[model samples]
Target chain A: MDQGNPLVEETASAVSSLSEEVVRVEGLWKVYGRESKRITSDKYSQMSKDDIRKKTGNIVGLKDVSFSISKGEFFIIMGLSGSGKSTLIRNLIRLIRPTTGRITINGVNITKLSENDLLEFRKKTFGMVFQNYGLLPHLTVLDNAAYGLKVRGLPKGKQYAKAMRFLETVGLSGWEDYYPNELSGGMQQRVGLARALANDPEILLMDEPFSGLDPLIRRQMQDEFIEIQDKLNKTIIFVTHDLSEALKLGDRIAILHDGEIAQIGTPEEIVTVPADSYVQEFVQDASPAKVVTAGSIMVEPEVLLYSWEGPRTALSILKNARRSGAFVVDKKGILLGVTNINRLERIIENPVESQTKRIDASAITKIPSVSEDTILEDLFGIVSANPYPIPVIGENRRLVGVVRTDDIFETISPNRGDQND
Target chain B: MIDFPEIIRIPLRDWIDEIMSWLLNNLETFFDAVGWSILQVMLGFEFVFTHIPWFIFIPLAFLGGWRMLKSLSSGITFALMLFLIGTFGYWEMAMQTLSLVSASVLFSLLIGIPTGILMAQNNRAESIIKPVLDGMQTMPSFVYLIPALMFFGLGRVPSVIATIIYAAPPVIRLTNVGIRTVNPEAVEAAKAFGAKRKQVLWDVQMPLAKPSIMVGVNQTTMMALAMVVIGSMIGAKGLGMEVLLSINRIEVGRGFEAGISIVFLAIIIDRLTFSLSERTSQNNQSHE
Candidate 1:
């Protein structure tokens, strides 16, 4: 739903203007130890986390981290363990206090809030899904899901009603009476998700929520989470160590490395134009076919035949361009069909001027066309099956451009070469 | 063997005696209040246990065992054990002993659980309390009697105090361990959902730590029962006094019957508590 030209900076700027800023974190640092304050200084900040730890006995959890999340955006903070991804997410909710800098959410500076106020702020602001599921073992599924509401001092009837609604949303309707341990890992996480969702907070902060599940279940949960997010339209800040998960679910991913951000970009930008060698190496294995869209690769055709044009005129245009086939469009550029040179020649040789007032219906061959936003991965079968270049259609069935098989191959070949090495 | 140097020997014994005397003099009113409250609670339990007809008590206890253990055989066995104690002609003494054990355990849990929570919450508290808990467990049960006597004088009050000192460590230690070892992710989840510190403790940590804490209670009860004979030396009444009297009179049959009654009581108490802990832990076993 957030489709745009990955290579274009203007589209990204336009998106920022369109969406409201919900969470802004600036120059945030989390240094762990008694002398954590020392590590925030410019001299110690320049050093790596390990080097700083060795010199001052203070471990750096995050260093000068800064990012802002827009409303309804699925923003991902991704890195391996010890990369401060978890720290960043925790810092957002102030579960782990930042040593220095500020976090302003919905225009209020949360870093300055007292502990009492922070607790009250968190209740209305964030719904968190933990990696370990974090369902209370003693509580039944319905009760666990209702824990947030219960803590907020909601009445028993209201709590259960809200919790049951979320449980149904997560497909756990019959499991209300069962304890968390009675369910499998995936179901337990579903309870975790339901608990978070029951609160109906402004943002969903997920910390590798599906990493504990089996791969198949993880994928299923990811898809279901996407559907849920689409329906709810809540801002989500997802943290994960898995690159592909980030690429799949994130509207934009911030790649963190050793307490620093390496890059922040859309999946296509990360794959196609990495910020540095670190980002390039991180995305090296990612198949561009999955991220690159037909719209980005499709080129303007050399020749086109309007439905109003005669076969003689179409033949001359085809002859000038030296092409076997040409796509035909209406006056407003809506794709009608394609006609090759042979079909044009036959129509002209018959000289059916009376019957063929316009281009004959029999002369045109209608082939399958794809929308511009269709990813390259889906185009492989269609591209290989058709002899002619695929027409890239846009809104209202307007023919935007054509994507040749060579374009798909060119977009994917670099990744294939990397994989071989 | 070389003789130890006299100059190097510390006056730790004198220092402790001085401290004990000072507490006896200065905290006499505080000790009296604590002693009176403990005596009243013990008497309340004694009155209830002694007043209930053996017929009604045995059947009720059997029903409790049956419900708690989910087994009719366990209930029947526990009921039979109570009957065996009566046959031994020490049913009255056994009731008195049960009251004392119950009172000691109630106080132990009241104090120990909170202490354990404090220890779990703060590293400094844990470090400070851990060694004291170790001393309570490892010290000879006889040594607690001296302080008990100094604070409450010779009576059931002193015996109750001594029994608590001897019995409270396991519950305190285990409660601390239980709360400390509760799944951290669960606590974090509670906090993330904006649960206050108090809510996190009662709603999350305490319930999750229950099985371990129940085990602690079981151990404390067993230890309190073990203190009965020792408690009788300080003028406490029960099957323990009967055993002490038999020991003094050199009557083997009387001592044997009293000892058998104590054994039966221990067995019945142990099984009921063990079953309770088992029930609490059942949630962990996977049904699938």
Candidate 2:
């Protein structure tokens, strides 16, 4: 908390440094009730599911949910189906209005906009991507890609150029004329992305964008999303139920439960120090050691270190560092050992440790320099890729810690059944 | 010879008796009553377009022409042509025919679009309407003539009534097809945008459906043109009457010329309406 929470930092970075806000929603609400007043009132939302059954009132699609999304942030909202993530995304663009909340976009309360003004605002700001890709079936890739611009009264020639450029950005350069139905799901999603990008909007709202695709495609899309983000640095709010996805893409994620913000934090916070049982259960299978950085687990600069001989072998290094078990290293290349037998077994038994071992400059295999700040999720991935746990190394390639499989397993498998991702 | 037939001579008495009873009781009385009722209805909706001073109609005609066809030359040319028809001594009849056709098509559309929208709203209505539209479409154009005669008379009104029957099917079919074909996702997207029930229909549904509905309108107008010629036999005028007059007099050259004129009219009207639909589609796509 002293260093500033990662979630808060991410949100701050997402908002303008020049200004504290990008988009603010003050008590956003959407209800399927006959009147607008019902959406704003807590009385209706507080009714128990049993009470609702007895009273037989309308369903509350989203309650007075209020959260601001900052600029350049990869904000994620995680929930089960029907948790109103979709409604929340829609409200950002005023595709739906919050019954009671004031949505300020760059200081403009979009809820007060007239129809024409609202259309202009939507046309000018915010790009949207849906799970199904929603490419027009009749249009070719180029046409579909250009639709946002075309719809905004841009001339065809200009629209086509913009569309083609974005199409190439999304890796669909050669697929300009291909129809939606002809393309693969990933290809179609690429087109969807291209279309959204064609307008060059500042904020992106992706509603389970890759959920409808196959698993392989989904993973590829997630990687593609990260790559794109790395290049564009645009603000993004990605909605998903897959916690793994939330971990992979989110800078900070907020879990929604029954139309409320259950918790908001970085992947490490969610996995390690979950706010509640609900948050804890959601991160049950993940190891905090892998998720949290060395900075998080390092015990103040005080630990015993064993200096080993040159060209130290993996078994010897393992014996020396973490002799008590795994020695986590500091940023200054100093060894900080929290190593012990129980930790060693845990690190060695990790599902990783097959293909991710480090190799020497020569063809020979080498050890990995695992720092205390390294996240367990990252460590688990590296460990899974090797048969032996990658030897954690330090400055001049000296051994630091020997991460094991059980370390990861211990991080997770603590207890389940309290959180919804 | 005796067994096969004594020529059925004994049935002559019964035949005479049956004929006399039918004439006295049902056939003669029913025919007269139905004939008179048909004539009266025609006189009811009638308006005197002939006495309206032709110059006043020109601007009104041009306004309609601009709105419907959106062409200056089209509007001006239409006015000139109507004027020419009058100068050529065929104005009164042409105006009558135009009015009848316009009235019938209007009434048909009024009934069709709302009905189609109703049908589009409910699956059961759509199911019921589909077969009815099919039946109406498949029925011979001549079949509409008898019903028109029964309901109205063999004049402008009955002819217009018949044209409605002939021209009505397309609007119903197309309206249903258009509403059905509207993108559900767009509707959903609109809903997500916070578009209310009415906004969804007007902004998303109707605008998207316009192209298909226009095609239906084109089909209806064309059918109306075709039926106008058939309606002329019952006293509706325009080129149809000219064609009939030429045919009656055995003036081969006149009939041929009149027939060619009808073809030209068909081409012109069809192109204009369809082109309007196409332009609208273009406009819709432009905004998208």
Candidate 3:
């Protein structure tokens, strides 16, 4: 509505940016049982969650939780069952009211919305997919998907067409007339996804959507969910107790402990640089290689040579750096190849008049390298087979850094001087 | 042995009678409106039942039973049972009894379903109505006749009222239980989707609670049928009156014939309703 006003338009465009903060929660606390309001005051606010529970027979569901999520980001809230992950997520969507604190979404404080306004805002802005694939048993698949649109007062024809499009997007085009009970769990979850998407809400709230699924189906569903998220790019606030799921899907992960946020960061950051002992213990059993990336472990290449540099020059650089290999890149930093002292020595010793090459022909293109975005786990075999350090290539085949086998070994046993250089 | 307590009387009946009199006096027009509506429904059912020839009604009943139960044997048994009642020379009286039962069940369902829905929605209403439903179920059926007579006087209307009071509780209680017992997750899903209160009740609650409500309707219909014989005591002419006349004359054969006819009618109605409820409910559709 304010598209014409330059200042208003700028702010709107800023909010629409993928990296702009969309959802912000400040000092949110939800305490259950008698006189929950007391928890907001000085007397109770200073007490620990357990102490408050013991002193006043109250259950702390959330405690002083504050975080802000960017637009189009897959933000995962991870915790154990009683850690208030669900309570926090529900509070975000206003499904469960917080005892005290403010939740501002797109700059509007949702905590202050009246009941009617909250419902209206929820209908317009948020679509939730539940853990149990909450499809109405009486409605057909199409009707289930169309339910949100119907509630929002879309015309009957538009609701059907939109629901059909969403169903097709979720790969459920033919099962439109079938009731939810007739569908498999995975299929029902697709319907749930479709239902949420059909409403065209700005944000998606998913509460353990794949938890009820078996391992095989859950994996498949996660792939499908990632694919859907890529296509739709909706701002998602996903809640899960499974650390693996959080690590797999989250662009940014928030770890909750005892109704309070332990840490919030990217998956790599959470795994490699956990904020506290709670988060460290939480991610201890999770496979680090799944989230550990080449870029995170890569170091500045000790020896690099211009492609124009002859074998003798490359040899000196590798020898000085105490390395077997040196990467040869063009002047623009695009990778050409790697040359080692052994290959240079062989070329120097076997220099025939007809074979006047600067470097050994075999070493010119045989070097194994990986992109900066490649996960370390994916290069396990590649890195182990090669004696030379794996060159970490960045955009346009530019040699950015190198990952040594020693670095890989150190990353594996993280407790030994566990500082990321 | 307890004659010493005669001085300390509990005047519960007096209190009830006073309340009843006050209700009758204060709400005369309301009662009259209700009585007129029920009488109209009764006459409508009576007209159709009495005017239909035995051949048409019998075949229709057989067809309904066959289709609803999906069994030929049950259908034949139902047809034969109706035929046996017909051969007893009480077809007219059976028709009258059928009309009365139908009217009573109609009103019971109409009143009970909304009351049940209300009780299911409101905890306070549930707590208040629960004991009242229990009393309605457990009280002597004859006791309802006193209030019915006092309110509407003796005739078909009073008998209908008495039968309704006796028959209505099962449907109300079952409806309440049914709606309440619907899966909370499904209700939560509806709420999460932004369904308004009325939309949630109609679209989610009612459909899921339907199987239980059907069971309630079946029970109510059977209870209404049970009230027919007692309803005859209030001067409503039917198969019950025939049984009463046979008892007065001490004719065992006549009484047996009339009694067997009543049994035949009961079996027919019960089987029909039970099978109908089973057919309509999607409960059988969901195996697990």
Highest lDDT: which candidate? 1
Q: Write out fnat for all predictions, comma-separated.
A: 0.67, 0.04, 0.38
Question: Per-model C-alpha lDDT, please?
Answer: 0.88, 0.68, 0.84
Q: Counting only residues 3 or more apart in sequence or on different chains, how many pairs clash (N, Cα, C under 3 Å) in candidate 1?
A: 0
Q: Give the i-RMS of model 1 in Å.
A: 2.6
Instruction: Tell me how far the alpha carbon of residue B225 in candidate 3 is from the true structure, in angstroms, after superposition.
Output: 1.8
Q: Residues B11-114, candidate 3, lDDT per residue (tens digit)?
A: 99899989998999999998888888888999999999999999999898889778888888878988998898888888999999999999999999999999
Report the error of model 2 at residue A140, Å. Answer: 2.3
Q: Which lDDT value does model 2 have at A82? A: 79
Residue B110's C-alpha lDDT in candidate 3? 92
lDDT score for residue B255 of model 2: 75
lDDT of 2 by residue, A303-377 (tens): 332323111333346565544333343345554333444443443455553222421122132334455445555
Candidate 3 or 1, higher TM-score: 1
Q: Clashing pairs in model 3?
A: none
Stretches of candidate 2 above 4 Å error?
A1-20, A35-39, A49-56, A272-366, A370-375, A381-406, A414-421, B1-162, B165-177, B187-288
How much is B198 displaced in model 2, in angstroms?
14
Candidates 1 and 3 compared by DockQ, better number: 1
Off by over 4 Å in 3: A1-18, A48-50, A319-322, A349-363, A366-368, A414-421, B1-10, B246-256, B280-288
Give the top-scoring candidate (TM-score): 1
User: Interface RMSD (Å), each candidate?
Assistant: 2.6, 7.5, 2.6
- Number of the top-ranking candidate, with DockQ as the measure: 1
